[model samples]
Target: MADLDPTATFKEFDADGDGYITREEFTAAMKARGEEVTPAELDSIFRVADGRDGDADGRISQAEFLVAWDR
Candidate 1:
């Protein structure tokens, strides 16, 4: 899985490689995975994966991706 891209987690979760993953996607990849999450969970998940510190920093780097996923 070294070729993995975590921020692209949604894309990977999309499975069929469609350009978009719908609420059903969120329901499956995130919620059904035991997140107890909802389709309306939050866009922040993406930003979080993108490595935004939300304190006016920049895009999340690859190292951040590893650390975040490691969580």
Candidate 2:
């Protein structure tokens, strides 16, 4: 996982190739990997990831994702 390129990985989750990753996109991406993630789990994750700025727009930008990934 650490070896994976962040930009490419982020793009994968972006799904629609949007500049940001929405909850739906993230969940879909996780499912594609055969991981079953619940809404609560996703909520917890976004809470932490988006908490970085205290203003989460319900979408994750590449820069925000990188910060979360490093942690």
Candidate 3:
């Protein structure tokens, strides 16, 4: 099994514990990781992982992010 728990990652990224990661929270999380994503890059990445079903709005859910990143 993968070592990471995507649910946990999601929780961490969600920040406000609101069950969703807003764009601001997402950017903050990346910055916390010492990553500086340009606006264009962030938008592109978000669009890719927003989920095919749109159940997550435009945010990447923990499970979805983990599976997508693991590849």
Candidate 4:
């Protein structure tokens, strides 16, 4: 797959314009992209994203989202 633009993708997923992607926003984004993420998969994604969360907030920041996307 072609590399996605992190900034653009991040903005799109940040539905609330809060500069962070909550789990709900992430799930909605995934669904919009036709990705049916299972609960297990969502948990895994959150775990990975949280691991990279510098501020320890539950939501994923742009930097954290970019890191996960690059991976």
Candidate 5:
């Protein structure tokens, strides 16, 4: 399988062009991608992604996201 481009994925989720993916952005991105997630489930998903590598800043920085992708 071809590799997933973490930067591209991150860019897709960083809707605001602010170099960070907020919870709102993440939720919107997921919904736009046709992900069916309830509010609680979305929160959990964001929490896990934001929590990866111990980054709990409430927003996802590209660095954090890249590290989470192990790239």
Candidate 6:
């Protein structure tokens, strides 16, 4: 598989163009990209992503996304 561009991937998942991704947006994007995640796994993903949510909001900002992507 080709290397994925983190910025591009993050933007695509930010469906609302608000510069942040909610749980719903993340799930939809992952599913559309052919990823099948269980509810427990999804929760874990959210936890990791939201850990970078500086404002404690339920959304992942571009910066946070980049950090997660790099990891």
lDDT (Cα, 0-100) at 34 in candidate 3? 79
lDDT of 1 by residue, 16-62 (tens): 66544444554566554566664345355545644444432323334
Runs in model 2 deviating more than 4 A are 1-3
Which candidate, 1 or 2, would have the higher lDDT against the true structure? 2
Please say which candidate is ahead in lDDT: 1 or 5: 5
Task: Point out the higher-scoring one by lDDT: 4 or 5.
Answer: 4
* Root-mean-square deviation of Cα positions for candidate 5 versus the true structure, in angstroms: 3.3
Candidate 3 Cα misplacement greater than 4 A, ranges: 1-4
Selected candidate, larger lDDT, 2 vs 4: 2
Query: Residue by residue across 15-63, what tens digits does model 5's lDDT show?
Result: 8789998878877887888775577876775687677747677777888
Clashes of 6: 0
TM-score ranking from best candidate downward: 2, 4, 6, 3, 5, 1
Candidate 4 C-alpha lDDT tens digits along 1-71: 13368888888889999999888998898888877778888778777777875455678888887777777
Q: Candidate 1 clashing pairs?
A: 51-60
lDDT of 2: 0.84
Scanning candidate 4 in windows of ten residues, the lowest lDDT window is 49-58
The ten-residue window of minimal lDDT in model 1 covers: 53-62
Query: What is the C-alpha RMSD, rounded to one decimal, of candidate 6?
Result: 2.0
Best by lDDT: 2
lDDT of 4 at 15: 98
Segments in model 4 whose C-alpha atoms lie over 4 Å from true places: 1-3
Candidate 5: where is the Cα deviation over 4 Å?
1-3, 38-56
lDDT of 2 by residue, 1-71 (tens): 34378888899899998788899999898888888888898898888767876777778888889987888
The models' CA-based lDDT, in order, is 0.51, 0.84, 0.73, 0.80, 0.77, 0.80
- What's the TM-score of every candidate structure? 0.39, 0.87, 0.69, 0.82, 0.68, 0.80
lDDT of 6: 0.80
Candidate 4: TM-score? 0.82
